[model samples]
Target: MTNDDSKVGDIPGKRSLRPLGGVLAAMAVSLTGTRISVVALPWFVLVTTGSATQTGLVAFCEMAPYVVVKAFTGPLVDRIGPRAVSWTTDLASATAAAAVPLLHALDLLSLPLLLVLVALIGAARGPGDLAKEVIVPEAAERGRVPLERAMGLSGVIERLASTIGLAIGGSLVALLGPLTALAVNAGCFALGSVIIKLALPRSMGHTAEEASSPARKTEPGYWRQFGEGFTFLRGEPLLLTVIVMVGITNLLDAAITSVLVPVWARQSGNGATAIGLMGSVMGAAGVGGSLIAAVVAQRLRRRLVVLTGFLLAGAPRFLILSFDAPLGVVLAVFAVSGFGAGFVNPVLGAVFVERIPRPMLGRVNALGDSLSWAGIPLGGLIAGAAVTAVGLAPVLLACGIAYFLTTNLAGLRREWQEMERTGGQSVPEPSSKDDASRGNANLAT
Candidate 1:
């Protein structure tokens, strides 16, 4: 049945929120650890090397593998099931993350060694993250929640993770050094691994193929499955357009967070505490915005919410920082930006889950996510070199202008007109290839 005919509580039997809660809890701890690294790792590289280029290189090493590995793992996630993939990868990531601090304490942590460790963490995180995204829809189904509200809750959890992670990260780096912060990150990953393994229902996170045809003998090859996802994505103009726009924005965001922000912290004499304070304030405001969106967003126009969110979320922070504004002024701009950002992912995620069929969810979602995130590795590299060649203010100014132009121009495209078509409920699997091709969707970075 189409979403219009299906209500949130339509499932006849008793619905359980346990599946959704487990997924979100796992997401929260893991994401919090990653956020802590966002603060601690860049600061660690910059202080240790005393070079912005090297700091950018460190980011490059981590994200390059993250994007590549995630792109290839979509079919594997679909075949082997997301649950097994999620736990195993989280465990691997925890091991790699823990190794960094342990090796450093022995004075054996060379720059090359550190890069290897972070790269390992990124590689493992790629599929680990994809598994979580793949499971959300099924979990939401088990919980009998609307897709929009589920995605909104996901956004809220993510924002909360960022607030807590950044605040603790900045404090730890400022007070006890980056190593202690990194150790905490490792512990968080381990805990998240345990949660996922033990908390979820056994029937959750299985492949759609398995659920639909367990007695079937034949299955498609890995490359064939990957190609199916690619072909389906290519047919959807709206999704393609969204991916392109998000790719550009993700690049700018990566540059700002990985290189520009830390450089600005050093130049403004604000130090690590300022970095933590700025991030936490923005994240705290984001939590408020996401909570509102979780409650009321289904009734709003997705297109308007997205365009407005981008208008507020993008450009302002870069411009504010470029002017060397007072700390309070900078934070005010960040809070506004963060609030706007809080509305974006929930809508986009709803669009994605509604358009793609359940069976193809893993592969299509992976390809869309990987493409949108394609430029992240280069963002820091380009920003770092540009800043070194000219200065921090000019680079920030240039990036801010670029961010404003790219987002607004993309909004003018006709495909975005379809953004409001989502019916606030889940779509069932399409019976034919052409039916699937007719569906529209959006993506986020």
Candidate 2:
């Protein structure tokens, strides 16, 4: 192996792993809170109003703000520093979430007010989440963690968080009611903000580009920074292709999670508890897959890992659901599907980290994530309507086939091939002057 390869292998020890530990802890706390709110908020809306449409509309309000704000805030994150953005916005989310239950108790809550509060929470969450994503590569580089390993670790954290959070959320809602769950969520977010603000080291505050840039003393205008991210993505076909693939899959996945699952549960004669259990099973499977990736991804080719994952993940759940399988069988199918999905994010994360320069990381990551997630609300809407019109089994089968074809066939494109071809070599760290110039360019339009 080359010296660079050796360096890659040795990365976990070069910088403090403490920062990664701190960041992941914060992420777990924040995500757990969010998951709890997901269950609690919808339950609150549905039980009180007795309207499924209203529940759907409330969800739409929350996600719309998330997609819109994240699309525009990438550059700001790059310019201002992710650390500041993460902590402050988390504070905002905590406040918004806390208000929902507190106002309800005070008899001051209205539907419109609740919708607006959830929207505010979504907006704050978008930037806060993006900031954390942008910081991952830098944190890895600083700690000498291999990019793939770091991203894999991130995926593991997310899966583990979701599993534990959803399980807890279900129990909380069942025992204490949704409002109490919301209150718990608020506390978690507040605590997460505190941990991130106080525990992380000063050196972890800035990107590598910022540390090396001499011109960093002068703050550029916002539009320029935004344009830079757009221009870079526009010029990179490989990046564009991956973004498109991710977006399509995200839309399909959203449909499965939000719409198809509930319909399937009802049709199969299982109640809401069974539906919740399906999620728990999938999440548990995902945690295992993510752990495997973190430990062994270096030995796998990125393209093959992604393609195989798509093949398994996209096909089985839909096929099983189409048969109106028993609840136990459905859970098993979804568990495998979750395993496949787990392989996806870490590889994709590593790819983005490797290709993008450090300075543009925040904007580009944010833009891509927002774009990919933008279709989630639409997915839920379309899936619900389609299931109602066409019946559950047919829609499930059709969507499953479409998802499988889209994800697997997209890999055949030439651009995807180019993106997957890594040379297994790491470039040397840039000198200070070069780093400064690169940083400036990365932030420029």
Candidate 3:
């Protein structure tokens, strides 16, 4: 029952933010590109190929490999180091991304070729993104920030990136066309790669000493390492619950982002401007909520915060769209949803970090996140087909209802109670004088 203030970092000064800052900067840069590609890629497929199905197929091609590659990349990260994996993967992604526009400009790009390029991007991004997340706890420890606050700030950075990226992506697609936006995305990935490759000191993701240790040499093979992660996940009911719930929601979100929103903009004759506007608004509100959560949420009961956040963040946007509501009302609903969504991840990140040991972080986190995101690849596909089949309103309504049930009902499990039991870092040892001082203060007070 010690307060959060009882903890402090052993690192000198606790003044340097470089480790954490570098990680965040890389995350921001890369994520911004991914978000832009989200808008631009689909638009490119739709406008060029004139097929929503093709768009979904391309999305599926990208994300399926993303999940699979990231799942297996974890062991290598623990062994070879996340830093090298991160930059190299980003370089691959950049090359793949650049080829799309280059080939298209040459008028030599076929649909099959486009799909291959998109898949390559997904494969590379999978590892790169995981590497960055893997770096966070290490960076946080080095900087002496509370794990929860660091996660909150991470959420803020992600929200900020998503906001700015979507805004810029939408604008670029509208004003300059999808190819230009794609070009910018390639540049972002390249820059992010450079930052991680050279900007941060060598100690961030894994130590060279650790990498060379006999224990490292003796570590299990890839499948065995993966099995360890799988076993860890299978044993954690809370983590499983979160993964399943998030998986469903992520699927729905993918549907919205990849198909619903873009289709809505096109059908409404509002085009890319409206899509960008909605994403920007939601991201902005999410940033505000993440900031507030970082400041005050640590003291609150975890289950309540999680449940309340789900209630606010889920269902509304889908329901609003289903109603064919006025744009103003839809925007308002999205804003509220974004705010509620903000409280969720920081809390989730804290719980996840506390529950897992450092050694197993990469594999476990990769598996968990990949599973939670398992449905993402299919999201666009399902939404595209559904909207094409029964029309948009029905699909939106079904998704909204499903989202509402999943978020609210899923929180009822006894396993979720685990969130409250976990403590941050290891408990500190209290010295004799410290105990004596505390007793004296208690008596005097």
Candidate 4:
């Protein structure tokens, strides 16, 4: 069926609820598994080696693969279909996660081996994550959900996952050892993969061209398709600007979370649980922000929401850390910061879904996501060195100020204004005549 036809099935008031429920359920399971590993893995490294640098290195290794692999595989996801890509990669991640704990149990775990396993998981997960994102527009279409609401629901899902997952991760680590927690994580990934594969409607997987080109096939060559995606993104200025802005913010965020926060916790004498709790608090507050976005995001100016979110999210937590506030106060500050951040993704997601053509969704989404996340490893590295040199508090304060300035200042650019315009309108549904022409052209291939 056509996308317009897909939108017709939902009753106005209740339409977004069902598909959003499915998406949120899938995200909760998957992110819970990831969050558990986030806790368990670092704890394992720190306990085993007693080296902060080593722990940072492990994070770097994982993110390096994630960025590189995702950047290159966007076209593959577009060509092969997100459903198959998502399920297969999730299975691979589950296997990698399970291997870590099993090897540890056998007394065969080594640092290099652990890094390799995590890197593989990251690589697999990159495309898998992209696949899920690519499917959002389709899911929203099928559910007759407004694009903003669908995106807002995604933000809520992430926030809920972070809050619940961190809480559960900490508890699991305390009760069952890091290895056992990891095993549980593996199980969650497996279950999540199954749910996405089975629970989603078959029609939910259809691409923009699927209805018209049942027997037509694209060229089998991988590099050509990959090149096409890159080429398309290069020509799209508004999209490029969004990617760059997100990338800068991501870098700053990575530094804050991975490097500065740990140092701050150690200085404050609260230890790792405090770090986890800080994250949980932020996540909890983000839930409220995400709900607000879900309810009213479509009515507000999209760019203003994003800019405001940046202003609120970036500086406050850093200032809190710089002051060495008590645990409770720090948690509160994080909550405020997270609440601001919660609105960001939904706005950006809706913008992307509205502007990008469905035929190129996989590659473009993958490319944008990979580029935005590329700075994560570098941020960790820089934060580690900066803390080692300048001490943690001063660096954190500087980062907070810089983040506030950078984001707000960037909003003044003409490119950002163009992005706002591009995102404000709905994508027009293509005519059947256009679809038929594209199909005939495809059949000749």
Predictions in order: lDDT = 0.82, 0.80, 0.81, 0.77
Please give each candidate's TM-score: 0.85, 0.91, 0.85, 0.87
- Model 2 misplacement above 4 A: 1-14, 205-214, 421-423, 426-445
Best by lDDT: 1
Cα lDDT tens digits for candidate 4, 31-146: 88898888888998898899988997897788789889988888787676776787788889999999998998899989999999999999988888888888777676656566
Best by TM-score: 2
**TM-score, prediction 2:** 0.91
Candidate 2 local lDDT, 1-445, one digit each (tens): 5542233323433655655666788898999999888888999999989998899889889989998898899988877778778889899999999999899999999999999999999999999999888777666655667767778888988888888887788789999999999999999889889877865654453544556667676756688778778888898787788888778877888888888888777767797878878888888888888888877776788789988888878878888989977777888888998898788888878878767776778888888887777777778778889988988888888988888888877888787776553566432242432365366564553
Order of candidates by lDDT, top first?
1, 3, 2, 4
User: What is candidate 3's lDDT per residue for 1-445, written digit by digit as tens?
Assistant: 8532222322333545676787888899999999899889999999998997798789789988899999888877766667788889999999999999999999999999998999899999998998888887767766767766788889998999888887789899999999999999999999999988765555555444445767666767788878888887788899999999999999999999889988887877778777766887888999999999887777778789989988888788888887777788888988998999999998898788766656677888899888898898778889999999999989989998999899877888888878884434321122322244334323322
Instruction: Tell me how far candidate 2 lies from the true structure as C-alpha RMSD in angstroms.
Output: 5.0
Worst 10 residues of 3 by lDDT: 425-434
State the displacement of the C-alpha of residue 394, model 4, in Å, after optimal TM-score superposition: 3.4
Model 4 poorest 10 in a row by lDDT: 4-13
